[model samples]
Target: MAEQAYTVVSDSETTGEEKTSSSFPEIAIGIDIGTSQCSVAVWSGSQVELVRNTRNRKLMKSYVTFKDEVPAGGVSDELAHEYDMLSGAAIFNMKRLIGRVDTDPVVHASKSLPFLVETLNIGVRPFIAALVNNMWRSTTPEEVLAIFLVELRAMAEVKLKRPVRNVVLTVPVSFSRFQLTRIERACAMAGLHVLRLMPEPTAVALLYAQQQQQSGHENMGSGSEKIALIFNMGAGYCDVAITATAGGVSQIKALAGSTVGGEDLLQNLMHHLLPNMDDLFSSHGIEEIKRMGLLRVATQNAIHLLSFDESVPIDVDLGNGTKLSKVLTRTELEEVNKEVFEKCEALIKRCLQAAKLEAEDVHDVIIVGGCSYVPKVRNIVMSICKRQELYSGMNPLEAAVRGAALEGAVASGISDPFGNLDLLTIQATPLSIGIQADGGDFVPVIHQNTTTPVRKEQIFTTVHDDQAEALILVYEGDEKAAEHNHLLGYFKIRGIPPAQKGVPEISVCMDIDASNVLRVFAGVIVHGTQRAPMPFMEVRMPTVDDGHGWSAQALHKMYGSTLDLVTVKKIQHRDC
Candidate 1:
């Protein structure tokens, strides 16, 4: 095995300005880069149209193969056989690994993939590699994603006969703000500028809104508000959203997401068939890699078959005197992945509760995504919403990308004569953004499911006597404990002027604009004064990057609550 050098386009060499079509009428494209598949669509003057590759396939496998001297992605690369993709040379599931630390459970789960995923169990980026020329070639998730995006861009350019620059991408709601930066970085690396990143369910809500508006116009009736419960479960994530739709507006009332999906189901069944699967693949020899790939292909085929059949047979012959034979029933498959189904149900219920809506209030129950084909997944969503059927207006696989295409047109200022372009999707925060206070407790200023383009503030007081400075540790998540959540960044509010504990007032404000940018402001005022002692500080969120987990622990170890602050009460402010 020998090390090989590969040259990639660096982002520093590119222009810093986000390329827009302000000079010319260019429509941004919509792309849905899923864990297993990817698609690109755009508005073709009058309506949204899906773009097809040279192979005439609309959905391309999301992977990058390094078997050749030059890396190739699924967008243009064609394999002789499906087994070739699982031969340790193709890297898939980059979506699950992007922006995740080594200590993340999701990163740990990704170790089972054919490619090399090495983690030190520390809060840092995991090491990923693909087999090329009999040597393990190192790569980052962001780099692999960028390579794939470049291919997608090339294909779109060839088809549309125009330069593809601006794009609207759809991401899972569970993605953190730091994770979003990774996505933007990948786009930048590919020389593409992202106009917007809509949550998967919210994009679907936009498409639904347009449908409802058309229906209202046809009936010549008032465009009444319709409450929709949307459940989206793809290969790597599951998301739930409750939206209020009227006319052409889709106002997202609540959003909940989790890292549970089809991948978990496949892995569970693979392990069920071979209990010693992990132990067998630990060596990573050529024979072992082949054996693992064989088992994976057989298991994947069985799962897809189970979607339409009562039972599917999985048979694979792994060389070195190993063989597997099993008849997998649909019920057995559901039982094996019981936790996945339960999580999907829980997300929907949690979203409904957050929106303060009952199951009866849902006028339409929509299920979309790759896993929506599974009987158990569909049943769980329908049963939770107490509906006999799901809304079948859009394709399960193409709904998200289609909605993204609609958004690209709308954001690009394209107008349709039939009012199809008159639409908007008002998004909400998918996770609560707050600070650590009251001894490691998470006190949220902007709670989850709160409408975005919002500004809210909370008042706090010093926790210790004679405290002149207070540390504001920003975090994001729904956890009650601050340490369990994702740390976005931190700052200090000083010049409090010597004061007794719980006397001085500290105003911490959080603002989210229409573009989904987050800015945190902190200021302090003395006990007997109406004005602050120092100027207010405002910092954009997600300042911390890799090793954020370690940073949070180190911050606690160094300060040890010396600069802690406790909650006083909410501040009365107008939320816009």
Candidate 2:
């Protein structure tokens, strides 16, 4: 293929930032920031191509080593051995730890890793630290992720020979809007603008849709619809999505995901091998950290080898005069991590159930991710789906990033002659979003599975007579009680005319645009007036702080029902 050149154009109407003419085009790359690995790719005019790092490798380890005063990600500098990665200087798995409070179980599990994770279970961000030069240097997950992204951006810039700025990143489907905010914040810290945060499975769905369009008949109708079950399991997360595709349009039907992944499996096998592994390497001394690293490397190798062989031999000598030797059989490894495999199966079943489809209805069972190559995982998924073969057209390791690159091109307003970029994925709301009403109940305005780029509203009224204000406490979940769900943000609508309880009509509107940014608008209108008595106040959702759990409780305790709202029948028709 000949080298293709693009023109850089700036829209002053979009960001209100001035754009200067450049020698090269500004191309937005697709980034798959995985739990254990990360990769970057771009639409190379003709096709999506992976950008190699300085080492000429596509997939780079997702970690940053703070051995020196200035931290460096593993992408540019390779560690000598597996033990060096666990030397208390390298921090990995920031994907799982990001956006989680200290009270989260996932944060607690991270404490088992070689790095230092201090938690208080008080709804604050955890303190993550890496040992550097005989001292523990504190850092945040956001900072670590930013460092890693900076390395990725540098690599892409060098490979593409352009100033890369915008990106389309793939995120887990289970990530809440608040979590999505944190990811964006990290991207900003790395000096990059996120064009879109596409769900990982949905990206794969887009790739599937493009492939079908390329091979389908000329006719475009409902008869050509194809249902695909995408199962994505990586190092730190497992996500399943069911999508319906036809004529290059893919509609997501259902999504299910969890934090269980290869990390959990490795920990389980480590314990099974030594049995007293925790006690053996409980201390954070240099020697103890080295021992932990050695054991981790041995365990990881055994797991990888088990995929192709029946059993593997593991032997390693701890610097502390401890000799470890064992033989791990495939059956024993599976037994040790049965729960992880079971969770994968449950996710697939739940997703299919929610989509109102059966395994037989699925035309293709696509598996993608680092862990998809595992024999046991493949067997369990194939058995559950009752399929004889897995989809083998796309590369398991590169599909997500490639799909993201395609989205980047389309979202950047780039056109292709081959029609590859002429694709769309109709996304759905992964969770219900609503406000607190009916005395602490979660009143959903936008239910789960609702199509995206949507607008919804629900009528609410003051709970007390002569009320002047109403609180809009937004939440995201399917739970009945507001407290049980994840609080996105909240705002207050004041200046209501004095009226009897449940007399004034207040409307709360939730708007999610194409990029999944949410905005909440609240206003009050009198019974006989078409115009709102008070001007509607629009505030972006997830305005709550990082420690939002406590904020919700504090708000309720400080002003108990003083500004609460109750659901009321819609009497006035107004455009939202």
Best by TM-score: 1
Runs in model 2 lying further than 4 Å from the true structure: 1-25, 218-223, 279-283, 319-323, 498-500, 530-533, 568-576
lDDT of 2 at 152: 91
Worst 10 residues of 1 by lDDT: 1-10
Error of 2 at 292 (Å): 2.3
Best by lDDT: 1
Error of 2 at 86 (Å): 2.9
Candidates' TM-scores? 0.94, 0.91
Question: Model 1 lDDT vs. the true structure?
Answer: 0.88
The sequence of per-residue lDDT tens digits that candidate 2 reaches over residues 217-296 is 75254447899999999999899999999888889999888888889889999889878877776666777777778888
Show model 1 residue runs off by greater than 4 Å.
Answer: 1-24, 78-81, 218-221, 526-531, 569-576
- Model 1, 397-496: lDDT tens digits are 9999999999999998888998888899899999999999999999999999889899999999999898988999999998999999989999999888
Question: Candidate 1: TM-score?
Answer: 0.94
Candidate 1, residue 246: CA error in Å? 0.8
